[model samples]
Target: MINRYGPYKRYKQVFGVTSHSNPDKEHTVVITDKGEWQCSCPAWIFHTPRKPCKHIQEAMKDQVVQAFTPKPITPKVEKVLNRFAAIEV
Candidate 1:
C-alpha cells in the first residue's frame, strides 16, 4: 500500500513532502527547505544514490503541477456610493 504525506507548508517559503508504503513505516521521502530530497528507504540508502526514489518522484510531480495551476478568481461586488439618496425619510 502507498500513502502520501504532504504538500505541507514549512516555515514560510518552503514546502515539504513525505510518503511511505505504510503508516507504520518511516517516511520514504522528505523534500527539504533547500529543495533537497531525502529518502529513508533502503533502496535509496543502498542502491540509488544519483536517482530519486519513486516517492520523491511522485511528490515532486505534485508540487510542480500545483505551482502551475491557476487559482480561482473571485468576482468583486460593487456597492452603492449613495444608498441614502433615494430614501424619503
Candidate 2:
C-alpha cells in the first residue's frame, strides 16, 4: 500500500525528486541551496504555487533529507545599507 505519505524510512533514501518518467530528464527536483521543491509534480504541474507536491513529500520522507532554511535577510539588508550609505545634506 502507498502510505498516505509513503514509507518514511524508504522515502529518506531519495537523493532528490524528479520526473518519474521523462525522456530527457530536463525536468527534475533539485535539492539545492534554495530548498526541497519540485516543479514537475501533478500537484505542482498546474495549480499549486511554488510549493512542493506529493512526490517531493515522498522524497523528503523517504530520504531523511532535511531542507535548509535560509537565514532571514538581515545580513543582506545590512550589506545593502552599507553599500548605499546615508546621504549627507
Candidate 3:
C-alpha cells in the first residue's frame, strides 16, 4: 500500500514527497536533479533491488505518463530537384 503527499519542489530540478502505508511512519520520496526517483523506505532499501517504489511512482505519475505517451510525428515532404541542372563554376 502507498500514500501520496504530492510532489513538492526541493530545489532546482529536484522534487520530493512524503508517503507511507502505515500512519505511524512516513518516508520521503525524492526525484533527483537528473530525473531519477528514490524512496527512503524499507521496501526500497532491502527489497525491489532499485525498482521504483509506490511512493516514487505516485510522485512521478505525471512524468511517467508523459514519458510513455508518444508524440505526433510530422511527415516530411521531399522537394524535387532537376537532375540535369548545370553545376555552378
Candidate 4:
C-alpha cells in the first residue's frame, strides 16, 4: 500500500459493472484510499450530495469477503501468554 507518495494506499478490489440499460456499457466502482465511494457513471458525476449508484450498490453487496479485524487482547490475557511463552516445553 505504500508508495513514493508516502503511505499511499488504495482498495485492492475494483468492480467493473455492466450498465443496466446498455449492456454494452460498463462502469468502474471503487472505494478510494480516502474511504470515499465512487463510481464511473453519469449519476456519479451530477449528484449534488453524492449517492451510491446502482453499480456501486451491486458491488457493495457482492463484497461478501471483507478485511479482517484483530481483537485486542486484555492485559490479563497478555500476562498469561507471556508466562506461557517463558515456560520451557
Candidate 5:
C-alpha cells in the first residue's frame, strides 16, 4: 500500500495518494486532505463527476487515523472550578 501522506509525513497536516496502477486506461486516484480518494481515470480527462476510485481504497487501508481528538474548554469555567476547590468550610 502506498502512503497518501508521504513527503508530508514529517509534517502533521497533509496526506497524498498514489495511483493503484500508475494511471492507466482503467484506473485513476488522487490523494487529498479529505482522504485518499479516487479519480475517474480516463473519464476524469473527459470531465465527469469524479469520485473516489479504488487506488484511494488501498491507501485508506494504510492510513493511520489519529485519535488524539481534543475537546474545547473555557478558561472561565476552569477558574470557577479552582475557586470552588479552594473553599474550605
Candidate 6:
C-alpha cells in the first residue's frame, strides 16, 4: 500500500498550512511529481534557491509528510535502520 493514494508515491501529497501573517488564511503545500516540495504562497513564489517558505518548511516537518516523502533526495546514500543478520563482534 505504498501507493494507496495513486501510482505515484508523493505526487498527490498536500497539506494545509496556516499563514503566519493571517491565521485566517491557509496555504496549500504539495509534492511535485519529481519529489520536490512546493507551496501556494507568495513568499515561495518569489524566492531564490535554498529559500523555502515557512509553510513548506513547516509542512515538511509534519509526521504525515514524513511518512510519504523522504528527506530531500540525496544521491547514492542509504540510512541504516535495522540489523537483520548476526555478525561477529
RMSD of each: 19.9, 14.9, 20.9, 19.4, 19.1, 15.4
Q: What's the true lDDT of residue 25 in model 6?
A: 65
The reply for model 4, stretches above 4 Å from the true place, is 1-9, 65-89
- Over 4 Å off, model 5: 3-30, 33-47, 65-89
User: Which residue segments of model 2 deviate by more than 4 Å?
Assistant: 1-27, 65-89
Candidate number that wins on TM-score, 1 or 2: 1
Which residue pairs in candidate 2 have backbone atoms (N, alpha carbon, C) closer than 3 angstroms, thus clashing?
A: 10-62, 11-62, 11-63, 12-62, 12-63, 12-64, 13-62, 13-63
Error of 1 at 86 (Å): 74
Q: Model 1: which residue pairs collide?
A: none
TM-score leaderboard ranking: 4, 6, 3, 1, 2, 5
lDDT per residue (tens digit) for residues 1-89 in model 2: 01122112212221323344753332322243334443334455565345676665665574453444322333433332233222111
Candidate 5 TM-score over all chains jointly = 0.31
TM-score of each candidate structure, all chains considered together: 0.41, 0.35, 0.44, 0.58, 0.31, 0.55
Clashing pairs in 3: none
Evaluated against the true structure, the overall lDDT of model 6 is: 0.48
lDDT: which is higher, 2 or 4? 4
lDDT of each: 0.40, 0.36, 0.42, 0.52, 0.36, 0.48
Query: What is the Cα-based lDDT of residue 21 in candidate 4?
Result: 80
Tens digits of per-residue lDDT, candidate 6, 1-89, equal 11112122334454556777787666656665667666666676556653678887777676254345333321211110011011101
Please give the lDDT score for candidate 1.
0.40
Q: Per-residue lDDT for 1-89 in model 4, tens only?
A: 10011111343445556778877665655555666666667786567677898887887776664553323443433343334223212
- Tell me the tens digit of each residue's lDDT in model 1 across 1-89: 32333333321111223334455543334454556665554565566334687755665666555434322221210011122123212
User: Which candidate achieves the best TM-score against the true structure?
Assistant: 4
